[model samples]
Target: MLHPEIQAKARAELEGVIGLDDNGHIPRLPDFEDRPKTPYLEYILLETTRWAPLSPLGVPHASTNADEYKGYYIPAGATVFANAYAMSRDERYYSSPEEFNPDRYIPVSEGGRGEPHPEGPFGFGRRVCPGQHLAMAGVWICIATLLATMELKCPVDEEGKELRPTVGFSDGLSGVPDAFGCRMVVREEAMELLGL
Candidate 1:
């Protein structure tokens, strides 16, 4: 909902992939099988993780031995934390870092202005979350299904002015959107497809 254009593009991809029935209803639900074929959806999921990582400060790591790098010294057994959030928005890696633009992850040859982002959302190295693959898969499926089935929009007030909630997050070990209002109306085709 924060980005209507991205949502529309995703919806178009879903319609192209899953297609519609003779009655103009979606023929079937998106599944894991469709993941590889939906590159845009993949970018959406990746951008989501990069835009707001669940663990801003990745799981801390302790150096097993003393080390020196870039003229900096590290003591043995020193606790170190990887700031994944900072890296995600680094200007060197991303243009318009503040904007949640999925096109940044798309290939330049495909009309997108940027290239695929380097991996970092899930911590680096062997210590990275073991469930990273499963997590991404789940997210992809959920996003794809949602885009294919519903229309997400920010709620409006009685005066018809759009009531966009302040984009804020909670303070804690994890970061998630603060309370906000959005309307998830099932698409007409989707409702019919679900026989509702």
Candidate 2:
């Protein structure tokens, strides 16, 4: 993984929630039942969304009435785009806007210094993505399960040098990561947990 510390922290959290059984293996996979107690995992998911939001420019909305913002006048019915990307990395809200730090979402009581706020990668207002909740839930479950059962690392070339992926996204309405290479190895305990 690019950030081993964060991955280790998440795995540690998983261990605390669904610890080993008599055979010294993780007894079960993470589920909705464990979601409430896995705050750190939640932070990781949130950070993933913020770091590379799928939709940089949210769905366009038309102004119902004429309005003025920062000395700019907008006629009625003018289409307005919410730059979700800018908001996600706004220096005013995030301390290190460019860094991918999940701890930013962790509460102060939990030893993290992030300020609590309602902003998310999802679009805002009444027009916000209707499936945001469902999408987040799905992403959370997938990420948690994967991190619990495998190790992700940058791939290596035939010469044995590690391939460091360039952190860039394709230009489009949606900001998708450019082609990259990585390696995923199943954890030894994963098979046992899977009853394989």
Candidate 3:
């Protein structure tokens, strides 16, 4: 809802892939096999993780041996937290870190910036989230499904102006965005396809 253009682009890809029935209704839901055909979806997911990491401070790790960086010294055992949030917004990589654009992941040959996929969202090294694969798959399908059928956008006020949300996130170990209002109207075509 915060980014309607992104949603529209994703939906367009889905529509091209899924197409419509002879009756001019959606024919089927997106499947795993659509991965290749819907590359934009992957970019969107990647941008989502990079834009707003779920774990701002990734899972803490304990050093088995002493380590030092610069002039700082560490004991044999110390707890360390990777600042995933800061890494996400690093200008060195992302052109406009504040903007929620997914096209950055596309390769230079594909006319995109070819930015590298982000790291540290799941974790670092061997301590990486064990279920990262499952989590990503689940998230991808959920996002694809929502975009396929819904018109997600800001709600209009009495004056018919969009009520752009004041984007905010919850505090703590989690980086869940604060709740915001938006419309999620099921596309008329989708409803007709579903026989609703």
Q: Pick the candidate with the highest TM-score.
A: 1
Report residue 120 deviation for candidate 2 (angstroms): 4.9
Clashes of each: 0, 0, 0
Q: RMSD in angstroms, candidate 3?
A: 1.5
lDDT of 3 at 86: 88
- TM-score of every model versus the real structure: 0.95, 0.92, 0.93
Each model's lDDT: 0.84, 0.83, 0.86
Clashing pairs in 1: none
Predicted structure with the largest lDDT when compared to the true one: 3
State which candidate, 2 or 3, has the greater lDDT.
3
Models ranked on lDDT: 3, 1, 2
What C-alpha root-mean-square deviation, in Å, does candidate 2 show against the real structure? 1.7
lDDT (tens digit, per residue) of candidate 2 on 1-196: 7897999899989889999777767888899889998988888877877778887777778999999999999999999987878888888778887898888887777777774443546778776778988998998889889888998989999998988888999877788788889899888778787666
